[model samples]
Target: MKKQTKKGAAASRDERRMQQVFHALSAPPRRAILKYLAASSLTAGEISSRFDMAKPSVSQHLTILKTAGLVSRDKRGQYVHYALVKQTVETALMGLLTDLGAMPPAAEDKPLAEQDPSSPTAGRARKSGVATETDLPPAEKPAPAQMSMF
Candidate 1:
């Protein structure tokens, strides 16, 4: 049926979009670019100045991000300004999490940081006899082991 074909085509598009998003996120430079754009839109040169790499490399990263729908570009005069597409990135990531059934239950009304420390769920690991960092007294806390450079 035409409906089934359309559904298949839509699914294919979604799959490609997800792949692009994940690929864009896999690179450290691209992630850094996204973080910079998150604060405010900046010209391509401004973004390139933040990193030690060549401008063309930064531009390539930006191009990949734009293709992934994670960033938008606007040309003003001779400069191209880049901005993060927060909603698109969030939607793509949340979609992947939903598809994998990894999304947290909606019943969690508050984030972990906002939850009361005395609440039943707050220290479930400690309650189960698992020794977390906070459970150890100051004197009894184990020092971090250092690795040898040799």
Candidate 2:
């Protein structure tokens, strides 16, 4: 349940919303388009002309961004105008990172046990030569069990 306060209810991440933002930003061309929009909204053709890539590819990128809700498309006469929906992009990334504890508080206090028991990361910690708080014991090969037939 979400809590309500004087400043209106706090916003929470919706996975679908994140999927939209991440999918849109996954392509380099789409990120470039967003940067361009941050400067000023541009028509589809205007953005298309800036890139050496074929216009259809650019259109496909634009379509993805539009689907993700990171970009809004408006039909202006015969042309389509695209603009960044900044809030959605910023919110999605920050929310994802925060939830994953990539940033502060929880990140700083994370328990070493959270790491996968079988991951090579343990070797990195030891090879770093810097003593780690993790201090995982070196893995030992278990004795092979002999099969007994009755």
Please tell me which predicted candidate would have the highest TM-score against the true structure: 1
- As a TM-score, model 2 comes out at 0.58
Off by over 4 Å in 1: 1-4, 104-150
Worst 10 residues of 2 by lDDT: 107-116
Candidate 2: clashing pairs of residues? none
Cα deviation at 88, candidate 1, in Å, is 1.1
Residue 13 Cα positional deviation in candidate 1, in Å, after optimal superposition: 0.5
Residue-wise C-alpha lDDT for candidate 1, range 37-136, written one tens digit per residue: 9899999999999999999999999999999999999999998999998767767766766677776645233333223566444565435433345654
Assess every candidate by TM-score: 0.66, 0.58
Which parts of model 2 are misplaced by more than 4 Å? 1-13, 102-150
Query: How high is the lDDT of residue 145 in model 2?
Result: 85
